[model samples]
Target: MRGQEMEHVLEAEGLGKRYGARWALRDCALRLPTGRIAALVGPNGSGKTTLLHLAVGLLRPDAGAVRVFGETPYENTTALADIGFVAQNTPVYRDFTADELVRMGGKVNRRWDATLARTRLAQAGIPPHTPAGKLSGGQRAQVALALALAKRPRLLLLDEPVASLDPLARREFLQSLMGSVAESGTTVLLSSHILADLERSCDFLVVLQAGQVHLTGAVEDIVAAHQQLVGPRHHGEPIDGVATVVRARHTDRQSTLVVRTDGPVTDPAWTVHELSLEDLILAYLAGSDTQSNHEAWGVAA
Candidate 1:
């Protein structure tokens, strides 16, 4: 599946990583199909960055495996050529101008698309000779993205590329990214803490919690399968053959639940409603199996 352009672009099974006795990622598994803009989300210590590093071959797994285009990417130049990564704070060579950076990329990557790089930067109004360090946060990020995209990578890995920008800058960065990917049909895996921004851009979801993947699927399927119910307060009971509660909370007179439903909710006692992508992501993250995560990561139960 990973070999074909129309199939899964990235695949991982039982992927894991560690720091001393702490497991940064544990038994992580997911498949990213081609041309999907997938969001990878989790709280601060849940291994989001670790997972991206592993996929891009910046770090090797301590156990299990990860494959990009069906090859282990650690030092695999051929596979690495097809993947591009932009890290947190949009790190770039501060001393290098956008033009210089493009030249550097052309020298290093065999498939570099210099025209695409120059065109994108020009459209974004980036000064060609300004050192990237002196450019605004948004411009520097745009330059980094252009460099990555100009390589014509099949899969792009972005790790919180807009986390530091102001709201307008953030929006512009995303718009530029979406525009380029749309034009090129590049598969994207983006990790960021801004859920609202993700909802607007990503169509697939990967939620991690306490160092393990808690959910993964197309965004629409996930939002549709999960429903919210509100009704008279009661012990959270399983709605057999109908819904499995993912999260629940109650007041004295009401119980509210988010459940994975099998069909139309027929129970007259409950009021069913749909969840937004942000709400659904929050529910799964809040309701994830932390006890198991504790065991997997060597934390006390």
Candidate 2:
């Protein structure tokens, strides 16, 4: 609407999805800039999968809209072709060999990179002749990654790609993902239920709760903006425009709060403590009272 529109690979506004009477995702807005691995973290039923599905055009939104690579991907074959998606459980043809999967991928995507796919699997020691169903979970996951990466997609979407992996396998998958991303500079939206894995690999952060985006920003900025302030209960906390309380616990004598603050804390009675990425995420997930806080613990409606 103004100067050049932001260079976002994925942009969604007022995005919503529903199933019968239940809203799977409601009034969501997100902008994923180029080349950032934005972690889409939420609990098991927190609409993470729903949002990913909407993005890849697997499921149409019931309200609002989503665009990929500057075009809505739903039924847009050309748009989907420029994107790579690794679904949950890393599903590949159970009956197809690793090599066959590669060949199939080459035919499906207009821009094929058979060498890249084969070379990646070959380097990972995945036997091309073996059927994918016979491979170990980690090996299968690697083959899935290889397939997605070989698409040379500008944007890659991964939905809980490591949920079923052991610790070692998860680490290996994430490492492979990061290395390939660094090499290709592909913008990625990786959804997960675990914070530790996302923290290690993702620079951008998004927190979703009950089908709404509770918070989104740079990981460091988010961690830096939130703090736990402990002070006298009678003094009252500074919760206004600059300080919005995300969570608070008050005793007769003292009040402890985790707040997203943008200004200096001048109250001498309060002791400020920094929040870890995990702590910050948990606070928002557990926060309450929609009408009370205006500055924090919220995203655009």
Candidate 3:
């Protein structure tokens, strides 16, 4: 696992979890490649945490299986050792100090890197003696990062690690995390609502909507091929030459669309424009809504 090219440090197949009348995640299949940073983006209640919990084995799926390094992770200490997860909010023992947490990692984890933890803390300007409860949200986030890194896990899973930090702190934390990934070649899966941050730091992305994957691909490929099209009034002409229409808006005199393309543009009346990451994500989210509405109205003609 250490030397070989692991196709996926983590993988899921037909994964799902149900809570009576509702699903937190449904048939969620994921394949996270090694040595890359992936951001999981979704709206609130969109099963981001559910998918992560299943991936880390905090929660078991009812319908399918999750594999971390080709083995089930639920109670397998060996499998767990290769994975480090920081929950959506920062996790700290209120009475403990940063140094104490590092010591605990040394005691409990087989691959602890105490020196790295201390060095990271020093570099982040986090005081070793400060109690967990006394640190600000941002400093606490740094401590959490240090603790997770100290384990020296091959894969790091972060759930909204910077959700509570200030803007400046969030930027600093992401920069530090990016640096760690660059230095260690560690695979990272961080979930966030901030598309801008994800666009900057993640090489890959998973977009979730209504408990399912709306899209998954390399960030560059997704952005490079999708186009926004605006055209003069066309009453009923269908757009061609794109794999999918992610968004379309009409205002009587003109029509605009966001389409996923893989070939040269051919339509004469439409203006094709490259889409930003934000445009791509918003289009996907909007697509989910349109699909649901179509289903409700039985309008697929």
Candidate 4:
């Protein structure tokens, strides 16, 4: 277990994918450690789904490579068995009852644990006889998660799993997920546009913008390394100790800059404010040229 915890759950090296004339993802790379709930954040069409699909072997990269548990995911039975994926829609057979789905999972996955599946569903208040089509959205999501968890996978990949549910339902679903993570020690890679949800559940963060990895690190470390500075407008004058200006906005008299820095902001000319995870992510996304600032921010491609 200690050796497993030390291994990387996912790694991408020079990964790229294209569709027709557009490159969905390009020169992307990141390493996610095992036993972490890593949040993948990006705007729509920023290649979040593409990256997730590639990681699960649902889509192949046009260039470079992606590995799951140090092995290529494509057509590798061992690698495939180690991963459990819940897509954006939380798809389940509409005609099948909750009990039927559990049975199907047992048949399909080599490591399926039927007892765990039934226990999770019971805890979520899902009746075994209820048809998936007749169940509430939250119930269906719970059923899907139960199926995934039943597989006893080493890595779990969730793509916007709660995007369609109501706030209370979302909270419940995440609670259930966290409970499973605690019990199973599964590494999780979850993608979502909801920053608040990510803040509550995730310890690691990966920010992808325009097919490139803009930032990747521990959530607390990234927040600690960035600051928001408000000061008098000083166009064309560089601020000392500022590693990179992620975003800059100006009013008539003051300039507000979101910056990445190596140390404390001792410059009295600027009032420094600590950033939240949402604030830091938005700053990177708001940059006009995120690729240009990667080196300065110490972000890998």
Candidate 1 per-residue lDDT over residues 1-301, each given as its tens digit: 4246348888899999999999999999989999999999998889999999999999999989999888898888998999999988888899999999999999999999999999999999999998999999989989989988988999999999998889998999999999989988999999998999999999999999988998899998998898888888969566643567888888989988888988888878988888998998888888865687689999898
lDDT of 2 by residue, 1-301 (tens): 5224447888889999999999989999998888898999887788999999888889898999999877888888888987899999999999999999999998888888999999989888999999999999999999999999988998999999999999998998899889989998999999998888888899898888889988988898888888888877844434543368888788998888888888877667778898888878877877744554444657542
What overall lDDT, based on C-alpha atoms, would model 1 receive against the true structure?
Answer: 0.90
- RMSD to true structure for each model, in Å: 3.3, 5.5, 3.3, 5.5
lDDT for each residue of candidate 4 in 28-129, tens digit (9 for 90 to 100): 999999899999999988999999999999888899999998888877778889898899889999999999999998888888899999999999999899
Residue 260 alpha-carbon offset, candidate 4, angstroms:
0.6
Model 3 pairs whose backbones collide: none
Q: Which ten residues in a row have the lowest lDDT in candidate 4?
A: 1-10
Each model's number of backbone clashes?
Answer: 0, 0, 0, 0
- Model 2 C-alpha lDDT versus the unseen true structure: 0.87
**Candidate 1 Cα errors over 4 Å, as ranges:** 1-6, 288-301
Worst 10 residues of 2 by lDDT: 234-243
